[model samples]
Target: MRTVRVELGARSYPIYVGEGLLPQVGERARQHLPGRRLMVISNPTVLGLYGTILLEGLRAAGWEVLLAEIPDGEEHKNLTTAAQLYDRAVSGRLERGDAILAFGGGVVGDVAGFVAATFMRGIAWGQVPTTLLAQVDASVGGKVGINHPQGKNLVGAFYQPRMVIADVSVLASLPGRELASGLAEVVKYGVIRDAAFFAWLEEWVEPVLSLESEALIHAVATSCAIKAEVVAADEQETGKRAILNFGHTVGHALESITNYSRFAHGEAVAIGMAVAARLARRLGLGFSQEEEERLLGLLQTIGLPTSVPPDLDPEALVQFMQRDKKVRGGRIVWVLPRRLGEVLLKEDVPLELLLEILSNQA
Candidate 1:
């Protein structure tokens, strides 16, 4: 297993990436604490896969384990769904010292982690991420949230996990399109930060897409390390860490405009990065056509969609972006591409320029 640590002082934890790590959850989690009830929150699809093994392992170790399975997908990321899981945790005899086990992909992690964040005014939660997107991004950062009607992730909190276990084995069961969707975030790590990592990915994207064991592990490990380093620097996105949202400002708006169904999170991000680069070039941030082409090309090579969802009103998209969390003081704080491997946060982007970008990219 490859281990990466998110150093948050008291909340510091390690992310373990390897094949068949699902069966090792009992041992890995016990290493964090002792004699606590675990409320395992997952969705039906994931529960049908690895839930039994995890239950058995913890049972064998004599830990009381309870299960709460929510329906899967981005559509379920809301207050009602979160409430059901919260209800289950409370009825399962949860205590302040007990832990909540988030046992699926990003959707599961986000809602379950939010439960952990709010349950008993914050309790221990560990991540057992099964999707590539969750393993590389969501599961590591401690930025847990549920989507509100107003926008995605509007109802949430910054609650760090006690540990994160990413089992490569579970990813094998993920359908092809879902796997491709996850790669969008993986590619984001390379685009906004590490040129060398991006180069490494250029060579390995095919192997990783093919689910070659070693390549996937290496990719997940490196992506986690990049996020960990950033999270340690800015746990609440006060400064430098905002660069991680290079594609997210517009990407989140895309998800919101589409009501989170028309496009996958990563797919929206794939398109968002392309648009942001054009905006960057417009603002003279040094990104050029070559950079935009390279990014779009990489996304296509990985089976990720680079096109914006058709029929979305450009004005409606702009209206949604105005409500994004990153926006402040009547200025959209766009995380723009200064160049490959570096991003710049610019405020007060002109309305006309942004609208023109919408027209072009849309």
Candidate 2:
């Protein structure tokens, strides 16, 4: 196993990435857990697949484990689901010293983390992320929350996990489409921070997508390392950390506009990145057509949609973006690309330019 540390001093945590790590979760988690009692939150689908092994591991470690199986999907990520989990925590006798383990994908992690953040005035928690997207991006960051009706992740907290175990073996069961969706965030990391990584992806992405053990481990570990560094530098997103939301501004707007029924989070982000690149070129931000094509081509090769859906209304999307958490004082803040592997957060973009770009796409 490979470990990446999110070095937040008092709040430091390790993200473990490798194959066959699922059965070792309890052993690793014991290092940070203060008590033997814990609850695991998972979706029905994931629980059926790996819950037995995880529960056995915890039980063998002398830990008492309780299970809370939530339904699968983004629509269930809300206050209602959180309340259900709260009931489970209370009935299961969870306490401040006890930990909550998020044992599924991004949705499960967000909801379970939120419960740990607010339950009995906060408690310890760990992550056992089962999906590539969650492993590479969501599980590493301390950010956890449910979607508000107004926007995505508007109701959440920066509650870091005690440990994160990302077992690449679990991804073997992932649907091809779901795996492709995750590549969007992987691509985002390359675009925003690592030019060399981006160049490497142009050749290595295929093998990674094919789930070759070495490539998959490297991709997950590197993505976690990049996110760990960013989160450590700007734990609360007060400055440089905002750059990590490279494709997320418009991406969240797309998800909200569709009520989160149309596209997965990473798929929406893929479209957002494509749109952002085009907009950057139009505004003379130095992104060349070749760069834009390369970006779009990579996304397409990974089976992600690189264009906005046909039926979305530009005006509605803009309205949703205005409600995004990143917006400050009613000004829409965009993380626009200057070139491959580099981006800047800008708030001075003219409304006319935004409208022109959105309208043209419509």
Candidate 1 residue-wise lDDT, 80-178, digit = tens: 998888788777778888888889989999999999899889888899999888999889878889887755687889998889989887888888887
For model 2, give the 10-residue run with minimal summed lDDT.
323-332
Candidate 1 C-alpha error for residue 192, in Å: 1.4
lDDT of each prediction vs. the true structure? 0.84, 0.87
For each candidate in turn, the TM-score is 0.91, 0.93
- Expressed as tens digits, the lDDT of each residue in 1-362 for candidate 2 is 78899999999998888889877788888888779898989998998999899888988888898889999998899999999999988888888888999999999999999999999889999999999999999898789999888656789999999999999999999999889889899999989988788888888978988899888998889889988888888999888898888888888888878877888889999988988888899888988999999899889889898877657788888877776544655566788899998998788877667766666642
Error of 2 at 118 (Å): 1.8
RMSD of 2: 2.1
Query: What's every prediction's RMSD, in angstroms?
Result: 2.3, 2.1
